[model samples]
Target: MGTKIPISVLVVIHTPDLRVLLLERADHPGFWQSVTGSVDGADEPLAETCRREVLEETGIDSAAHVLTDWQLQNRYEIYPHWRHRYPEGVTHNVEHVFGLMVPDAVPVTLAPREHLAFAWLPWQEAAGRCFSWSNAEAIRSLPARAAAW
Candidate 1:
């Protein structure tokens, strides 16, 4: 595969009642977070990346939900283990944040290679469980975002 784009999307999938969905990484076992993936190509839109990752990772058709781009972006150093996926010397990534609101906690079909398991937890608990700081911050912001939605 070619080197991945440094741009990515972090999608917070949650219910109207503040229950957020968390996915366990197949590669990391216990490391859990929201649906996240790099853009498939340099020309792809971040929102499209968000939608695609949500479906590819959790089987959630985000097009059907209220997928709102929070207009938030976070740039962080790529973890050493995952840096190999990007171009040589590219050590950071810019992740656009989005929120996909479903009516309630819903069953999900995990993509076996990407995710090993899934859970819907209260927003507070979900935030606490996220492995990435950026992912957790997005979950922590869910309550206010949902309140305004």
Candidate 2:
């Protein structure tokens, strides 16, 4: 397998009403977070990667939604169990932030191998439920970020 890139995109899918979308990780059933995926290759810009990941993982057409690049990034250690996906000696990843604003909470088709189910929850509750500290941090910052827009 190719070396996993140390960069990723985390897209917080939410509506103007503050309903946030959360997807349960397939590998860790109860662990939930926003839409996320690694950048496919160096050739793809991060914004494109965000759009692609949202569509691939949740069947959400990013172009149709308002996808905002939040201009934020989180550098975190790779989870021990997931370190195998990275190249030897790689220890950290940089996850860029984005947000997809839909009109309302809607059903999503989770990619079976990556995610099991989905829910739309209030931002405060969603922030508290995310498994990753960085993911939770993003959700927690959403209100302020949205306000800036």
lDDT of 2 by residue, 1-149 (tens): 23889899999999997889999999888999899889889888998999899988999888988988888989999888888888888889999998899998866888999999899999999999998888899889888877887
Q: After superposition, how far is residue 12 of candidate 2 from its true place, in Å?
A: 0.3
Candidate 1 has an lDDT of 0.89
Per-residue lDDT of 5 in model 1? 90
Clashing pairs in 1: none
Instruction: Give lDDT: candidate 2, residue 98.
Output: 89
The per-prediction CA RMSD against the true structure, in angstroms, equals: 1.3, 1.2
Q: Output the TM-score of candidate 2.
A: 0.95
What candidate 1 gets wrong by more than 4 Å, as runs, is none
Candidate number with greatest TM-score? 1
> What's the TM-score of every candidate structure?
0.96, 0.95
